[model samples]
Target: MTTANNANNNLSPWQPGQSGNPSGRPKGTRDLIGYVLETTDGGKELIDALLFIVRGVTPNVVVQKGTRPRKGQQVRPADQLKAIEMLLDRGFGRSPQQLDIAHNVSSRPLEHLSDEMLKLLVESARQLKEGIGGGYW
Candidate 1:
């Protein structure tokens, strides 16, 4: 007869889409956790993880998506660097030594962040700061 070890070898680790609930969260648990998990609050943990990883590779830089500036609304590279420094200071509660770190790990700068992208990043950072013991939010 097949044993549990045999079953274990055959089955892959849990995946959300494999089931109705991809997070291995039980069915209907999504109904309850969905609001929280799908929300800024719920997703803050993941967002923070991503940001932390980016911060780890470089001290004073943040990686973000690239986008074109809106008409009549321009952001210069210097200002973008300043904004990144400000965001890092606010989120980490520490002073940044430089406005922007050279692409030590990535080729892009934060200025390339789009309005929507920046909005989400700021919101995520804000939510995480507030949710955690960090008081910068």
Candidate 2:
């Protein structure tokens, strides 16, 4: 039977501590998102667009070089809802999810458990994580 070290060695072509690509991603090439959100005004523009949608306001757009800004159609309800969700998600972290676990076993220190008990505890924890059983022994 192949050990973990042997399996890893078989999978990887390069030696340990050696990078697969010596010349990695080019230097001075910033991520597109970083460039848009940090370096440019795109982030502010995005926030403004979201706010406009949430407020049901029509965004203004310039038609020509000298022409006055024209009012676009009112933001759709679906789009407004999506924009509100996005703004809320960005402004505050996502809401917490509540799990309905029904475990009967109270928490105990690992050092107090025997080897067999430890194995059972580990299996019980796994079952709880997978939402398999209602309670653990």
Candidate 3:
């Protein structure tokens, strides 16, 4: 059995009043892209444009494929199904998958039956086995 050292395992353990990752990013620090965007003057405008695109504040226009004119056609509003899937995965997690079951089954022994009954039981068992391409008794 392999024993791992928790302190040296690289993940920061919880402390009483401190965040788990004290050595990592500070509390108010944004990610690199976010920081860059927030710092830039045109970032707000760019973000507004993206928001408009996502929220359909403005219409979606895509060019029609395989045409000489290739004129722009207005598309339907975007569905946020991927966002829902991401949120569901992060919040409640995914569900366990069901297993496929084989149809093979077994029956009890015929030792307690009478001699005639035992003969009939054997014959019936044989027929059942043959019907299902046979398996062990």
By TM-score, the best candidate is 2
Q: Identify the runs in model 2 with alpha carbons over 4 angstroms from their true place.
A: 1-31, 38-42, 61-72, 102-137
TM-score: model 2 vs. ground truth: 0.45
- Could you estimate the TM-score for every candidate? 0.20, 0.45, 0.24
lDDT of 3 by residue, 31-132 (tens): 766776766553655444344445534433222654332235332344234434444565588755444547443454556568998787688779757854
lDDT of 2 by residue, 25-44 (tens): 77756676687788438588
Per-residue lDDT value at 83 in model 3: 38
What does candidate 1's lDDT look like per residue over 54-100, in tens digits? 44322222234564334444345565565566667767888433334
- Pitting candidate 1 against candidate 3, the one with the higher lDDT is 1
C-alpha positional error of residue 72 in candidate 3 after TM-score superposition, expressed in Å: 2.8
Residue 81, model 1: lDDT of 62
Counting clashing residue pairs in each candidate, in order, gives: 3, 0, 0
Worst lDDT run of 10 residues, candidate 1, spans 54-63
Ranking by lDDT: 2, 1, 3
lDDT of 3: 0.53
